[model samples]
Target: MQVHECVSFILLKDNQVLLEKRAQDKEYDPNLIAIPGGHMEHGETREQALFRELEEELDIVPTSYVYLCSLYHPTGELQLIHYYVITQWTGTIVSLEADEVAWHSLEANPLDIEADKVALAEYRRLSLSLIIL
Candidate 1:
């Protein structure tokens, strides 16, 4: 099985969170809303992975972040995810690797964005994490 290591950040500011709508052409389910983060590369720590993903996907440099948790999933496909909280960021958001970017209110949506709900249970358990598959 292919092992995938990733990270997702709950980027919040003034009660709003940064949400991205995945492109329709994305290998993942279309338009799924996700937090800002992605896979870890070889020899990369969780912070390194988070930084890389943030710059690659959104071109934003985070000013501050904190490790929140980690999860290992055995969803018939093994995957590990490192979750974090991005409380600060620099450089205005100018990249749109996703189909769209929106500053969403925490109360506006139900916060269910994953296709494989069970695999993402860990995130739901964390009050600060936005769970996903």
Candidate 2:
């Protein structure tokens, strides 16, 4: 199995969330909008991987953070992603590794990731599940 340790941030501010348009250079999710994160290199923990990925992708560091949940790829790849809530952060957004970035009011604007149907389905599941919980 192709195990990948990935981390995604819920970059929220006053109930808004940030989503990124994937760079066309990407083969896996080109032209899609998704969260900021990537695969963990060998020997890295989930938190370390997340911090490194967020810094590389978004050019910011969190002032406070915690894990929200962990989920697997539908294909059964292990150690898929640990979702983190980044409610507080430092610095500005620059050096964007994505094609574009947008802040969405998730409550009012539904976010979408075009090429990543699995992740999108996961997002939709979370959205619906949150309403009842």
Candidate 3:
């Protein structure tokens, strides 16, 4: 089986999070709601892929973000996904690839992919810890 390296960003603003519905024709997770990101290109570091994907998908460049976690996912194919939390960014959002995009209540946890669910749990835990600190 072929494995791909991927990077995804969870964009947080106020009490909402940005999410997208994958393009209906996508090979994996078609029309599923998900965080924004794509596969890493050859020779790119995780952060590099993260920033590039942000720009490519949403036309935004992250000004502030942090690595959250990584997960191995098997959907249409195997994927090693790196997750990030983006707190700040520059540029207006213009969806370039997804079928739809929207801001949703963070507490709603609107997601479809199993890997995304696991990543979101980690995000919530970290956020609560930050608040408690």
lDDT of 2 by residue, 11-129 (tens): 87766678888788875556666766778888988888878887898888888876666677533345466777677888887646888878887555444542233443455566578
The backbone clash count of each candidate, in order, is 0, 0, 0
- What is the descending lDDT order? 3, 2, 1
Candidate 1 per-residue lDDT over residues 66-123, each given as its tens digit: 6766666454456676777677899788546888777877656434444223223343
Candidate 1 accuracy as TM-score = 0.75
Q: Model 1 Cα RMSD, Å?
A: 5.0
Query: Looking at model 3, which ten-residue stretch has the lowest summed lDDT?
Result: 124-133
Candidate 2 local distance difference test against the native: 0.69
User: Would you list the C-alpha lDDT of every candidate in the order shown?
Assistant: 0.67, 0.69, 0.90
Candidate 2: clashing pairs of residues: none
User: What's the lDDT for candidate 1?
Assistant: 0.67
Candidate of highest lDDT: 3
Error of 1 at 76 (Å): 9.2
